[model samples]
Target: MRRLSTIIALFISLSAFADEGMWMLGNLNKQSRQTMKELGLKFPADKIYNPKKTSLTDAVVSFGGFCSGVVVSNDGLVFTNHHCGFSAIQQHSTLQNDYLQDGFVARTHEEELPNPELFVRFLLRTENVTPRVLKAITPGMTEQDRQAITDSIMYAIQDEIYAKDTTLVAVVDPYYGGNEFWLSVYRDYTDVRLVFAPPSSIGKFGWDTDNWVWPRHTGDFSVFRIYAGKDNKPADYSPENVPYHPPYVVPISLAGYKEGTFSMTLGYPGTTERYLSSFGIEEMMNGMNQSMIDVRGVKQAIWKREMERSDAIRIKYASKYDESSNYWKNSTGTNKVIRQQKILERRREMEATLFRWIQDTPAERENLLHLFSSLELNYKARREAGRAMAYFGESFMNGPELVQLALEILNFDYEAEEKMVMSRMKKLLDKYANLDLALDKEVFTAMIKEYRSQVDSLYYPDFYATITDEYNGSDHAFIDSLYAQTKITTPLGLKLFFEQDSTYNIFEDPAISLSIDLLVKMFDIHQVIQEPSTNIERDERLFNAAIRRMYANRNFYPDANSTMRLSFGTVRGYTPFDGAEYDYYTTTRGIIEKAKAHAGDRDFTLEPEVLDFLSSRDYGKYANTDGDMSVCFISNNDITGGNSGSAMFNANGELLGLAFDGNWEAMGSDFIYEPDLQRCIGVDVRYMLFVMEKLGKADHLIKELNLR
Candidate 1:
């Protein structure tokens, strides 16, 4: 097996001074500490992450594996972004009790709503398991064989760890690609409850329109409480479970920060491809992103119309719309930033430099050159299949809700499928009572057209031929017919279909038939691209290993894989474009201004009570020294999708805000960090306190926080 030392050295040679990486909590080095100190971090590195003693890392939790949250009170109060908890809020919402629209404030512990599957995981510890795992691989081993051996070893290690501690959820993650591996053990608390949330007027103040925009006034915060058994251990939701006493809780700081104030963010960042080659970037920008944007645009258009028609439909699809629009806008912003920033050209330049450096080192030249060539070829070969897959994802898989239900029903046995089918039918009827068959039909039709036009004819599903020959090439007519003939479209049809005998064939249903055919086509495409995708992964692993070796002396952080990480920076604003400067923070005054500018607009309209409070300027203790109520603030802290709900701390490690969104101009920061432009948007802690006390009138909940 080849070593990665050479590549690390090469990477070190190219390193420069820039705060651009997500440093893992347990792996901070002396240089990282020094950098943090220079950037205004007042706490020692050990104080931030000490396995033997309670530290800041103990306060941070992986919120259901998708977002980050912080423990705020001794009694297990957790703080995160409202968007992070939106799905839970949606689940508990209904027309009679619209928690999403009016928000919910648990005045007493008994009032807190329980979530069925929500969880918060705290890191126990991490150990380097690279050598033990790598011992399984040998030179010239096939990728499949290598993966199998690695998995077996990893599972064995995890089992060994679990044997000693049954409470721990053990996971092994590869860092620097497969060059290094670490075992992370976590204690997952399953009994999480919604404590408090501001109405959508404040929580989702600007909604989709101001999603990634800066100078934002949205108070995008939500509160949840973690419950544990009497033993203070993880347990299922039960009335007997009490508020958990965490090892540490973040102390809220009302001392407002200004431009250049030191700040740090600790959370789980989902993913980044900072080491991607220009070939990969081109494929992502032109193929995957474009397909998602186009397809989701069509889906969202239909959903918006149905949702606006009634409050019930709006409640049913609020989370779905938010989730879909988030990435739709992300794809749009990323493509725009990629072009505007000339990221491809920059990557090409870096590749050129790397190649030149490799050539000088004859020992490494051939291997490095072969890796890049193979990667480029693999990406080129799979671009079309990738685009086709993206379209399939956006269309039949995610376009209409009924298609997914039909596919799920097909997966179950007749004897066991009845209960599942009945439950699904009830849910479908209850949630989507205003089922817009015509709108869904239109969306499905448009998506199918997109897939046919974008993907090659050779890759078309068998049903395409059925539509073209039997239905006369009319997707609209075919989809309309499918809806009319499908059992899952309505509760009566579904119940009637389930009444059939064991001899009944689900494939006879039009929706089920189309779904199965599409699934088969997707499988076929996957088979076609399997080899190339495998080769790409293998080459990327090698490439990452080489980079690690080249930068051996420099402090390197792994790309975020939904694990806890700490990123530090300062509170500073930027000029995203020439002659347009933004302030470091937004205040309640700005919210009022925006409300006035877009009065009656759903996205900008404030609740009448909130409007009245703003009119009187009665912020009380939550007001800044300047007599203004701070809402949102921006920091140069590096963050991504999963960092939402992460704790933004001041120099003294006091809670400053909850990290939410990143600036639009820095959308490409996931792939290529633009230090000057990339900024983390957070809802200030003061704003949360103000909303809880003055607006929400939940001073009891506010009293739980250790305010400074």
Candidate 2:
């Protein structure tokens, strides 16, 4: 075990140059730059990130605050993952013109559909704010106090900027497990509009089945244009808004990638726990991930059954179902990898060395002894509560659509006069306007029963007593009574209730009471776990600092926190098991093979036109040297959730593809980087162009790209 740990640590040192760290752009070290150059970086490090001028970083945008994207033309034409733009596409969809089903392509600027809530933000600057953040920390201050001091300083810095221009978003994020801090200031353009999207059949070809899998045929690309005021500044959605002209636009390389070609991805990777203690990783595997997998399985099954019954229901629940299933499937993969690889035991072995190093010197032992002790204690203390929290969140907060609506009502300002309060409630309900009452009723009942069965009686919502005493422990009966008493469930009742609201008190309603109980129970769990969780967080931070000191000669990258970062590697494949070797790229032939193999399958079902198109011989402009179109390829770039839609660039700093997913074999790499198996799955840029131009017939949008 010690030998294995030492080998892994050494491999991580070597792999740092291959595809390990999500490096900070603001502080590109000399050592990293030289390595990148040796690997075929065409320009200097400044070309990738330069604070004084527009660099490749300027072209990258945080898509709708959740995913990453790149500006492909001077007019701010953004290319992101189809999934990243899915929510907006679904929102704009209607039965009359189903964009989600049939796809949308605007022929002219005027025809483009506006997404008011969606925005893409550019990285204006990233500054090291470590000194400012750490200066106020006292020697013996509690973690909470230290955090409060950090927050005050961060707020003061951001508030000063906000006073000048509210559109300028500034966030001070902790790095290296709060050992250091950096501030990222961004320019957010909110008037983003959909320009082109392929039908779901192409954009999301294999759906959940193909997600996180290698050799993917999913096109997984969407196009949107950022709109700004006449001055090219951020503005609200309006008919008069013009296409945003960006400071820089990334050039698309039509040339494809070789197996060992140098590749890099720059994006906002959501989170990673590479420095997390073994105890924390085990908790994540057995507790949070397990609860998510179990609860979402039930929810997806229920939603799928309901959705298949009616087109109306399908359209209403498409986004909800996909969101749930994607993560649900991801959690299952993470746990599988953790167990198969014995990740928990390996982590413990690594920690053993870390502790042994601490004990070698009395000075080191004196300073860092609390790390393991406190982490072990608090992690054990919070184990059950943490699992309960995950179950409560999955089953209660995210289960039923009406349950979410109930939460919204809980926060509603009911103090307004009758008509105002009624209007507000109607508006709030409209936020989830597509929810099917029947489907929600079924889901809500099942969730209540599932929660009760999974968790202890102490964690039960106060409303559980009503189900037990009044309804004889019948979830269906209790749920039925709640809905029956709520006027909003029926159109006529809602209308009448809205008409005469002066005498009505919704706070006394059964449904409202049930929501309150859910909130109160969630709060109780949070309260119980707060102290222990804090201790664990503090211990982890101390552990992270100590590990860095121990490995002073080795490179240590901070765990991702949804900030702009760059990760580099080669376009290479790997052997997953004893005898099986995977290719670096999957061609168009695989698409036809998959479509035919799973002809009647919903996930593999492609539109007849798309099938015929793939079946036809010539891949034309997108074809590689073998005269076959590249669908997707694999690399070892470190990426996570938010890296979806990020531009994958070749050594020449030209676009190769879009970083969309990570291979399933390395799903647990978020906690522990699997140097041998970890590979980034990306949709070939040429494939995206082929779909946009040949399949979608969006030549105007295709022509707008600065193709090389």
Candidate 3:
């Protein structure tokens, strides 16, 4: 039954709802004519502005990968994903000051601690590169040729600009296969600092278990400031540098919109998989979700155990634990929904209808479907074997060591990349090797024994080879001699060797290097080895067929990823799966209620003096009684991860709220936008003001806001 269930899940893996398409933006077609007309969302091409609509480009910045943010201040004061800001917060954390667990706010400019690795991107310009780009390439071009042409054109464009603006970078992005192109110029700043954040209790109120599940009480938002040169240009860390002062910052309106008001979320959205094949959905539903669930479940257990016994581990893995727990819940929830199958069936029907309508020949359709199918099959073939890469997957954890090794290699004139690879091997060897020969042999033998006992033989071939070779080799005396010469014995001895030896090379020794080489070879083999070409061909045919069909309908576009897209919707409310309806409201009262619940909980423990203000409902000091909106509310705006810190604006261009999260119902927006299910949650400007005035007791900060 367990095996059967696992097989069933593999077929359901592609159930991404919110992942691939234009979020919930496709509902523009299905929107009631009355609602659409009321929203006045039919902004024509002339009025619509790209990032550089005017002197002030909507600061398009990526806060690593989990989320995105926008610059609300001209002088580089940016807003972005709360989750995105997590790493920065974590980086700044120390034993004495747990910034991740406790929120941080730097009241003064000098008070703000510079986050060395944090970066913000300014979208300088974007242009259609299709004509110039495609001129050098053609339809029958191979992927290699297409990439070469694309890279050449991109380099040419960027090189020209790089000469003018050394701070800026030009990236060429592809759209509609190889037919269309967008060349974008970005000004990047590395010196960023934390501005203000609610405690984890408030910022991530519901924590990971609540992520991607709507009716969410989690306040998933954060703010950051980008510092630049005194002349308003991007700059590195400098005490002399100042906050960027832009010509325009969004003006916050006290008069919040009611239901049916026109609203839009404008910011970078990371990725979408709306164009994925049904088989792809099955993979996500079964494979990705299940894998994530299993991993996160283990992580959560570790976190739970550590949270109770080890403060150090809790501190170290605060963000990781939160993420794992959240993903576990989210994946499980998503898996559950996919298993329901109604949504998948609906999506399949839509795909079928699209296929029937597209003017593609049977051959073309077959080719597309084959493409998608091949991808799925390949993924499955590599699925379990890919676990070898997991231990070294995170760029954040691995990047610094690689960077140091690259610098060392640079000293010897070796390529930085090659040095980094050597550094990786060095680390791996250190992990498995020992310092004292007898103990080393014992440790290595025991470790290999564990590997043999635990890890699947199919995955850990190199480790398996160690145990097998010890027994099978005729040179038992040679093995004893080698073991005696070996330095490593106990785990601590091996660790000490790595710590003390600065000039060890895993690649220099034949036995060690060969073993290391085998690991790498197997890792690669696991990553790429797949079913025979016949299955691959069939999958591609399936994908091409699906795309042709989807294109035929033209009812929905493939989901946009990290691509600029405009989503239109209205301020509204939604009913949750549990039959509870959320009104377009959240108030200061809710904040106080949450605060009182955690009288001393890190998220809510207000200073004793502040409690008096809440009791008095001294809202007059902070609350915009005019609209009386709770600090947070809902709007029917289609958005995703990239839309963090997006300014939610009214028709007259007044900022109403900061776009944060989509209601739980809209989690499916990742794959397919269901208008009825999609609603954007935001922190109203009024609530922001109230928090600043009443709770924060920093009414002085209000002056910086462009309040009308």
* Predicted structure with the largest TM-score when compared to the true one: 2
TM-score of each: 0.93, 0.95, 0.74
lDDT, candidate 3, 238-266, per-residue tens: 89989876545666666666777777665
**Top model by lDDT, which number?**
2
Number of backbone-clashing residue pairs for each candidate, in the order shown: 15, 0, 78
Alpha carbon lDDT at 369, candidate 3: 34
Q: Tell me the deviation in Å of residue 462 in model 1.
A: 2.1
Per-candidate local distance difference test = 0.84, 0.85, 0.56
The C-alpha local distance difference test score for the whole of candidate 3 amounts to 0.56
Residue-wise C-alpha lDDT for candidate 2, range 372-396, written one tens digit per residue: 8889989999888889999999998
lDDT of 1 by residue, 544-628 (tens): 7676665577667788888888888899999999899988998888989999999878899887877887778888888889898
User: What TM value does model 2 have?
Assistant: 0.95
